[model samples]
Target: MGVWLVLAGLNGAMAIGFAAWGSHGVEGEAARWVGLGSQFQLLHAVALLALARFCAKRRRLFRPAAGLMVVGVALFSGSLYLKALGISLPIPMVTPLGGISLMASWLLLALAGWLACDHARV
Candidate 1:
């Protein structure tokens, strides 16, 4: 949880940098990529912050959700950042995989909440 919080803070900072660069330094497609990546990274950074807090109470489920979110942000936003800078990965499907990972993380988070409510009732 501590690690996740630190990572979330750092990611938030980087996302801001990306957004700044995208808005002021770049143009055309690169700007769009940076803008989109920054948006996702920033949003996920905030989510991770909350998840890190929630993980303290529900380590079993929130931990994995946090992990998936970390990986998802790295792959998805990282790929976009790289693309904006004209670097291409050998793997063509990285962005899509990242999106899938992010979706999976959200589903897991929801499941954790639902299960916790069920346990509370019982």
Candidate 2:
């Protein structure tokens, strides 16, 4: 959890840097991609922080949710950042996989909330 919090902070800082760079240094399509990636990265970093807060109490659910979110943000935003910087890799499939993982993380979060509510009722 501590480690995740640190990661979230780092990610948030990186997002700010990327957004600034996109706005001031880049132009056109590259700027758009960088800005979009920074937005997603920052949003997910916030999510990661929230998940970290609850994970110790609900490891069965939040743990996996956090893991999925971390990987999803890394892959999704990472691919976009790479593209924006004009770097091409062999594996183009990772971006979509990251999207799927991000969607799955949301489902897990909902389930975790449901279970928490059920447990509270008991």
lDDT of 2 by residue, 12-119 (tens): 999999999999988999999899989999999999899888886756989898889989989998898999889996986988988999999999999987876857
How many clashing residue pairs appear in each of the predictions shown? 0, 0
Backbone clashes in model 2, listed as residue pairs? none
lDDT of 2: 0.89
Best by TM-score: 1
Model 1, position 75: C-alpha lDDT score: 98
What is the Cα-based lDDT of residue 61 in candidate 2?
Answer: 89
TM-score, candidate number 1: 0.94
Clashing pairs in 1: none
Compose the digit string of candidate 1's lDDT tens values, residues 1-122: 79989989999999999999999989999999999999999999999999999987756989999999999999999999999989989999999999999999999999987877857557
Off by over 4 Å in 2: 119-122
Roughly what TM-score does model 2 have, to 2 decimal places?
0.92
